[model samples]
Structures are given as structure tokens and as C-alpha cells.
Target: MHSLNVALGARSYPIIIGSRLLGDAQYLLPSIRGRQVCVVTNETVAPLYLARLLDGLPGFDKVDVVELPDGESYKTLNTVNRIFDVLLEKRHNRTTTLIALGGGVVGDMCGFAAACYQRGVDFIQVPTTLLALVDSSVGGKTGVNHPLGKNMIGAFYQPRLVLADTDTLATLPDREFSAGVAEVIKYGLICDAPFFHWLEANMDALLQRDAAILAYAVDRCCRDKAAVVASDERESGRRAILNFGHTFGHAIETVQGYGVWLHGEAVAAGMVLALELSLLCGSINNNLLERLRSLLRKARLPQRPPAEMTVVDFLQAMELDKKVVNGRLRLVVLKSLGEARVADDTPREKVIEALKNCGVR
Candidate 1:
């Protein structure tokens, strides 16, 4: 197993990545004072691997499992309330630990639940999707989407441990697998130029599920993320780099309605738009822009927003994004491959021009 630790001093935790890690999670969970445990998952994931996870946690005094209807739309206050109902029904106390046993949706919902359940509680992340494995599971960011904004109502509660079983990818659909690769590529684009080049060379191997290559990618991504989180656990500054394509991406998701485009797919196109804006701003050269687009194309991720989305709709949605600070849209743009910086100074005319050029109406 390949293990990487996110150093947060007293809240430090380890992320375990390997095949069959799910079955070994019981040994990894921290032994807390309370024996109450709740496993939060969605219907789709519960059937396939929930039982295996249950088998791993043999000796807990009481275990409660709540499976919600699966989808992005279900990530709301209602779902979080359902978790509260379960916790209250089980009479769980402050020490109860919540286990997030699915992808980003599951992780966000459960983590938020843990944060609010009796003020605070411990939680573990078992991210099944590659996107969640590389990004969401590592950060302490947790929340449900608001009707007006995505991730607007959330907390920065870190998980006690994160278990990533690469074996879970076996059940992922082709589209979902491609979607996950978007986040994998984001890691390279925003931070590691060499890893970006390595992905360009090993795209085929990654697609074919070559274990060694995947293990290396996951480890490196987690290490890069750990350093960032340790430096700015509450996203005071440095951690914003992790949202490289997310500003435009969240706008896409909200404008198009969530789930129409997977989170990674939106990010794929968002990164392209960000790169174009960077080039227009004279921050990155044309050759580097082409290189960025080429890698995304090789991964089968979208490079433009859906044809039907209008420019006005996108602008309205972007205005509501949580990342916007002091009424200005804050965007994470790349200066070159493996390097990114936040820019709130980008002109609206330039952004609209880039969107138009990319075929957004």
C-alpha cells in the first residue's frame, strides 16, 4: 500500500492508496472514546462495496448506515438532514465518527454532516472516484450545494483518515473514468510541469489501468496537495491554487444545472477557458496553451462549454460562485504549466471575449 500523510499537527491524518484498502480500513481508523459509528453513502455505491466496508469494521459497538438516492441534485440540506436523523436515531454522541464511503458527493455530504452533528465529530473519507481521490478527499473543504451557489454552505473540517482503493475504478463507467482524469490532469497543470509531461506520455497506460502508474500518480498528487493544505488548511491563500479551473467549472455546473456535466468534465472545459484567458493576458505562451489543450484532448475531456449555454447565463452563475471575494470574481489562472496564481483583476470584457471565442453563446 502507498500511504501519504497530510500534516495538520493535532489533526494530521494518512491517506492509504492501494487495491483492497477498503477491506483493511478497520485497522486504519483511529480509536476514539466512543464506539458509535455511521457510514454515509449513496444508493449506487452501497450495493457494490458497502458490505465490504462493513466487514472491515467488525468491533464497533454500533454501526448505522444511511444510503441516500445517488446524484448531484441530492446533495442538499435535505440529505444532510437525513444524516442527522440517523445520528439522532442511533443516539450518537460527540465522539461518534462519520465515515464518508463514496465519491465527492458522498464525502461532502458526510463531512458536512459530521461538522454539524452536535457541533463537531470525526469523519473518514473513502473516495471511490479518481477525482475525489486526487482532490476533494485531501482537502478539509466540505459542504452541500446551495441553490444560488455551489459549495456555499460548508466547513473546513478535516477527515481523520482517507482510504482510496484504486480497485473501485473497476466499476466506474467509461464516461466517469474520463471525468476523473480531468482532475488528475488539473494536478499536473496547476503544480507539476514534469508530471504534466509524464501524463502526456503515459495517457494510454493510465487509461488501461496500469497499477504502478496509477499508484505513482495518486501518491504524487496527494503529496502535492498535502503540502498545500498544511500551508493553508483554511484556504487563507495558498490553497486557492487547488481550484485552478473550478471558478469557471462551478459556473458551468450551476448554469447547466448540476449533473448535466460531471464536475470533472466542467473542470476540463474550465481549464481550457482559463488557459485561453491567461494567453490573452500575456501570462502564458501560445505553445504552452496548445500543449495544455492537447493533454485534455488525449484524455477525452471537453475543451468547451456545451453549445446551448448562453454567455449571460454563465455570467450570472459565476457571479454567485463562493470564490468571488468582495464582489469581484476570483479566478485561478495558469502562468505556465505547473504554475498557477489567483487573479481577481481579470477584466469582464476579456473573460467574455474568451468565452465567446470558446463557442459559448
Candidate 2:
């Protein structure tokens, strides 16, 4: 097992990454601080792994499982309320621990439920999907999506533990796995140039699901994200760098409708747009842009925004991004191959041009 700690002082927790960790009681039981436990998962995952997880928690006083309907479309307050309904019906107290046992959608809703239930409660993340293992399950960001924007209504509620069982990746579909690769590649683009180069060289091994390579990629992304989250827990400054392509990405999700494009798929295209904008703004050389584009192609990710989207659609959706300050749109763009900066000063014309360049009408 490869174990790492996210240092949050009193709220510090460990992330365990390894094979066949799902049914390991030693890992799961140690994280729970209370007798009562709730396991939140999705329909797709419950059939495959829920029994294994439940079997590990034999000592708990009470264990409840809420099998949520899966997918991005279900990431809403209404779905989250279902958790509350079950918790209340079962008379769960503040001491209850919520275990998110599925992918990003399940983790987000469970964490949100834990944060809001009885004011607050502990939660553990058992991210089954690659995206959750690498990104969403690590940071404290939790919330249901609002109709107006992605993650617009959420909380910075960190999980007590993040247990990523690489074994879970066995069942993930090819499309979903590639989506996770986008986030892995984001770390290299935003801050780790060598990792970027490494990915460029080893994209094939990763796509082939070479165990060691996949584990290393997951751990590297986690470490990068952990450091940033520790430094800017509330996204007051440096943390926003982590949203490198998310501004443009969220716009795609909002305009196209949630679940139509997976978050990672949208981010894949969004990163391309951000790269184009960076090139136009002279923040990065064309060589760097082309390199990322080539790397993305190797990963089978989108190289541009969706053809159906327009410049106006992007502008309108981005205006609703959380990064907007006093009506000015802010975007995270690359400063170099390995570094990023938040740019709110770019002229509106440049934004439109970048979108147009990427095939936005």
C-alpha cells in the first residue's frame, strides 16, 4: 500500500492507494470514529463492490447503505436530500460517519450531506473512479451543482479519509478512464513540467492500465493537489491555479447540460481553450501549446471546445463562474509549461478570439 497524508493540522487525514483495498477492514475500520456508519454509493457500483465494503464493517453498531442513481445529472440538491431523508429516518446523529463508496458524483453528494446533516459530520471518501481518486476525492470541495453553474452551491468540507483502491479501476469504462487522464495531465500543465514530459512519453503505458504507472500518476496528482489545498484551503490565492481549465470547462458543462459531457471531458476541451487563450495572450509560446495538444491527442482527449458551442455561449456561461469578481471574468492560464496564473485582465476581444480559434462559433 502507498499511503500519504494530507496535512490539515487537526483535520489531517491519510490517503491510501493500493490494490484490493476495498474489502480491507484494517483500512476502512480505522477511519471511522463512530459506531454508526452510512455508505453512499451508486447503482452501478453497489452491485459490484458494496457487499465487499459492507462485509468489512461488521463491528459497526449500525450500517446503512444509500444506493444513489449514478451520473452527473443526479448531482443536485434534490438527490442530496435523499441522503438526509434516510439519515433522519434512521435517527442518525452528529456522530454518524458518511462513507462515500463510489465515484465523484457519489463522493460530492455524500460529503455535502455530511457537511449539512446536523450541521456537520465526518465522511470518508472511497473514490472508485479514476477522476475521484486523483482529484475530487482529495480536496475538501463538496457540493451539488446549481442549475445556473457547476459547483456554484457547495462547501469546502474535507473528508476525514480518502481511500482510493486502484482495484476499482478494473471496472471503469474506457471513456471514463480517459476523462480521469485529463486531470492527471492537468497537474503537469499547471505545475509539474517533468511529469508532463513523463506523461508525453508514457501515455501509452497509462492507457494500457500498467499498474505501477497508474499508481504513480494517481499519487503524483494527489501530492500536487494536497500541497495546493494546504496552502490555500479556501482558494484565497494560489489554490485557484488548480482550476486551470475549469473556468472554460464549467462553461461547457453549463451550456451543454450536465452529464452530456463528463466533467473531465469538458475540462479536456476547456484546457485546450485555455491553452489557446494563453498562446494569444503571449503567456506561453506556441511550442508549449502544441506540445500539450499533442499530449492530449495521445490521451484521446478533446483538442477543442464542442463544435455546437458559440463564443457568446462561452461568455455567458463563464460570466457565471465562481472566479468572476465584480462582474469581471477570471481565468486560469498557463504562464509556462509548468506554471499557471489567474488572469482577469485579458480583454473581452481576446477571449472571443480564443474561442473562435478553437472552433467556437
Candidate 3:
């Protein structure tokens, strides 16, 4: 087992990465301080792993289980309220600990529920998807999607612990697994040129879900995220780089009507667009862009948005993104294969060019 600390002092927590961690009580005992335990999951995830998770938490006065309708479209106040209603019905108090037992959507909604339940409560993330394990579950960014945008209504509620039991990934559908790979690629793209090269060499191992490669990737991503969260917990500066393709990614999700294009799929296409913008900016060469496309295509991720999504449709949705500050839309763009920065001064036409040229054709 490999564990990394998020380093926020009093708010610091450990992210445990390994195989079969969800069934181990040792990893969970330290994080659950309360007697009431609530496990929040979705329809698809509940049957396969929820029982095993419950078996690990041996001694709670009362335990609650909530199974939400699965999919990104269901990430909203209504679904969150279902978890809230369960907590309230079970008469759980502030000391109650909420355990998120599925993918990113489950983690985000459960964390938000914990954050708002009687003000605040403790929560743990047992991430079942690659995207959650590598990105969303590690950071304190928790929120549901709004029809107008992605992750719009949410809170910065950190989890007490994040258990990434890679064994659970065995059940993810092929497309879902590919989606997770998108976030893993983001880590390498934003920094770590060597890691990106490693990905190019080992894309086959990742696609087949090799245990050693999976653990290594998860551990590296956790450590990367932990360091970033430690430095900029509220995204005041450096943390924004982690969003890499998210500005465009979120717009893709909103325009595609959520779940139609998975989060990682949208991000994969978004990264293509982001790199195109960087190319137009004269910062990166065609070789780096081809390398990105090669790796993504090898992983079977979407490299472009739907052919019908127009440039104007994307521009309209991106205007409402959370990353926009004061009237400037700050996008995470590549300086090279291993470096990225936030740029708000991108010319509208160049931005349109990226939207126009790199999009579905």
C-alpha cells in the first residue's frame, strides 16, 4: 500500500492507493470518528462493491445506504437532497461520517452532502473510478453540475481520507475506464515530460489494466495532486494548472447534455482543443500535439467533440464556467509537453480558430 499526504496541516489527509483497499478496515478506521456511517453510491455501483465496503466499517450505531440514479445528468440538488434526506431520516448528527462509494459523481455529491449537512460533517472518498482516484477525489473540489455549466453548485469540502481500491476498477465498462485514463494523461501533460513519455511507451499496459502500472499511475497522480492542493488549496494560483483542459471540457459537457459525453471523454477532446490553442500561440510544436493524439487514440478516448457542436455553442457555454475571473476566461494552456500556464489574453479569433479547427470535422 502507498499513501500520500495532502499537507494542509489540520485539514491534511491521506490518500491510500493499492489493490483491494475497500475491503480493509485498517485503512478506514483512522478516518471514521463517528458512530453513524452513511455510504453514498449509485445504482450501477451499489450491487458490486457497496456490501464489501460496509463489511469493512464494523462498528457503527446506525448505518445508512443511499443509491442514487447513476450518471452525470443526475448530479444535482435533487440527487444531493436524496442523500440529505437519508441522513436526516436516519437522524445522523454532525459526528456522522459519509463514505462516497463510487466514481467521481458519487464522490462530488457525497462530499457536498457532508459539507451541507447541519453545516459540516466528516467524509471519506472510496473512489471506484480512475478519474476520481486521480483527480476529483483528492482535491476538496466538490459540487454538482448545473444545466448551464459543469460543477457549478458545489463546495470546497475535503475528505478525511480517500481510499482508491484499484480492484474495483475491474468492473468499469470499457468506455468508463477509458474516460479515467484521460485524467491520468492530464497529469503527465501539465507537468512530468518523462511521465508522458512513459505513457507513450506503456499505453497498452494501462488499457489492459495492469495492476503494477495502475498502482504506479495512481500513486504518482495522488502525490502530484497532494502537492498542488497543499500549495493552493483554494485554487488562488498554481492549482489552476490542474484544470488543464477543464475549461473547454466543462463546456463540452454542458453542450452535449451531460453524461452523453463522459467527463474524461470531454476532457480528452478538450485537451486536444487546448493544445491547438497553444499551437496557434506558437508555444508548442506539431510533434507534441501528434504525441498527445497518438496516446489518446491508443487509449480509445475521444479526440474531438461531436461534429454538430458549433464554435458558437462552445463559446456561449464557456462564458459561464467557474474558471472565468472578473470578465477574463483563464484557460489552462500548454507551454510545452511538460509545462502549462493559465492564459486569459488569448485572442478571440485564435480562440475561435482552436474551436473551429480542432473540433469535430
Candidate 4:
């Protein structure tokens, strides 16, 4: 098992990554306190791994199962309210620990629900998808998407523990697996230049789901993200760099409808757009842009925005991004191959041109 810590003073927790860690009780039972524990997951993941978790968590005297509909569309205030309904129905108190199972959606919503329930409660993240295992599950970023923006209605609620089982990725659809790779590549693009080159060489190993490669990628991404989260837990400054492709990506999600494109897919295209803007701004050279695009293409991700979207649609949707500062959009741009910074002074016309260049109507 590869174990790492996300230090948040009193709220610090451990992240355990490996194969079949979910079925192990020692890793789970210690973090779970009190008698009642609630497992919140989506429909797609329930049949596959819920029972294994339930069986492993024999330490809890009272266990409740709350299964939600699968997909990004269900990540909403309405869905969180459903979690509240279940907690109230079971007479759960503040001591109840909510276990979030499945991918980023399940982890985010469940963590949000736990934070809201009885003011605050304990929760664990069992991230089943590659996206969750590396990025979303570890950073304490919990929330649901609003109609207006992505992750706009959310909280920075840390989990008691995060357990990522590499075995689960084998079951993921090809598109979903590729989507997760987009985030992994972000780790390299934003920081870690050598890792980017490594990814350039090893994209096939990841797509093949080589056990060792997956473990290494998840561990490396988690360590990098943990360092950033520890430095700026609230995204006050440097942490915003983590939203590398998110501004435009979130716009794609909002315009296309949640779950249609998948979060990672949109971010994949969003990263391409970020690189384009950077190229136009003279922040990066053409070779760097082509290298980034080449890696994304190798992963089977789209290099451009969907043809159905318009420039106006992107701008309007991006206005809802949480990175807005006093009405100015703060986007993370690459200063070099492995360095990124927040730049709110991005020219609107250049952004429009980049959007148009990327196939936005």
C-alpha cells in the first residue's frame, strides 16, 4: 500500500492507494467512528463494490445504504437534499460518518452532504474512478454543479480517509478512463515537466491499465495535489493553479449538459484552449503547445471544443466560474511547459479567437 497524508492541522487525513484496498477492514474501520455509518453511492457503482465495502465494515453496528442515480446531472442541491432526507429518515446524528463510494461525483456530493448534515460530520472517500483516485477525492473539494456554473455550489470539506482501489479502473469505460488521464496530464502541465515527458512516453501503458503504472500515476498526482492543497487549502491564491483547464472546461460542461461530455473530457478540451490562449499571449512557444496537444491526442481526448458550442455560449457560461474576482475572470495560464499562474487580465478578444479557433461557432 502507498500511503500519503494531506495535512490540514486537526483535520489532517491519510490517502491509501493500491489494489483491492477497499476489501480491507484495517484501512477503513479505524477512521470510522461511532456506531452508525452511512454509505452514499450512485446506482452504477452499487452492485459492483457496495457489498464488498459493507462486508468489510463489520465494525459499524448500524449501516445504512443510500443509492443515488448515476451521472453528473444528478450532482445538484436536489441530490444533496436527498442525502439529507436519508439521514433524517434514519435518525442519524452528528456522529454519523458518511462513506462516499464511486467516482468524483459520488465523492463530491457525499462529502458535501456530510458537511451539511448536522452542521458537519465525518466522511470517507472510496474513489472508484481514475479521476477521483487522483484529483477530486484527495483535495477536500466537495460540491455539486449549479445550472449556472460548475462546482459553484460546494464546500471544501475534507474526508476522514480516502481509499482508492486501482482494481476498479479495469471496469471503467474507455472514454471514462481517458477522461481521467486528462487530469493526470494536468499535473504534469502545471508543474512537473519530467512527468509530462513520462506521460508522453507511457500513455499506452496507462490505457492498457497496467497495475503498476496506474498506481504510480495516482500516487504522483495525489502527492502533487496534496502539496498544493496543504499550501492553500481554500484556493485563495496558488491553489487556483489546480483549475488549469477548468474555467473553459466547466463552461463546456454547463453548455453541453452535465454527464454528456464527462468532466475530464471537457477539461481535456479546456486544457487545449488554455494552451491556445497561452500561445497567443506569448506565454508559451508553439513547440510547447504542439507537445501538449500531441499528448492529449495520444490519450484520445478531443483537442477542440465541440462544434455545437458557440463563442457566446462559452463566454456566458464562464461568467459563472468561481474564479471570478470582482467581475474579472481569473484563469490559470502556463508561463512555461511546467509552470502556471493565475491571470485575470486575459484579453476577451483573444479568448474569443481561441474559442473560435477551437471550433466554437
TM-score of every candidate: 0.97, 0.98, 0.98, 0.98
Candidate 3 least-lDDT 10 residues: 352-361
Which pairs of residues collide in candidate 1? none
**Better candidate number, 1 or 3, judged by lDDT:** 3
| Predicted candidate 1 versus true structure: per-residue lDDT over 37-134, tens digit per residue | 89999999999999999878878899999998887888898889999999998899998989998889999999999999999999989898887888
lDDT of 3 at 183: 92
Tens digits of per-residue lDDT for model 3 on 1-361?
A: 8788889988999888888788779999989998999999999999999889987989779989999999999999999999989999999999999999999999999999999999999999999988888888998999899888899999998999999899998998989989999999998899778888888888899889998998888888888888888999999998999989888899889998989999999999999999999999999998888999999999899888778888888888888898778877888899988899999888778888988887543
The full ranking of all candidates by lDDT, starting with the best, is 2, 4, 3, 1
Q: How accurate locally is residue 195 in candidate 1, as Cα lDDT from 0 to 100?
A: 90
Alpha-carbon lDDT of model 1: 0.86
**Which tens-of-lDDT digit does each residue in 1-361 have in candidate 4?**
8799999999999999888787888899899888899999989999999998887798576799899999999999999899999999999998899999999999999999998898899999999999999999998899998887888888889999999889888889899899999999999999888889889888889889998888899999999999999999998899999999999999999999998899999999999999888888888988987887888888899888888899999999987788788888888899998899999998789889888777778
C-alpha RMSD in Å of predicted model 3 compared with the true structure? 1.0
The residue ranges of model 3 lying beyond 4 angstroms of the native Cα positions read 359-361
Q: Residue 31 CA error for candidate 1 (Å)?
A: 5.0
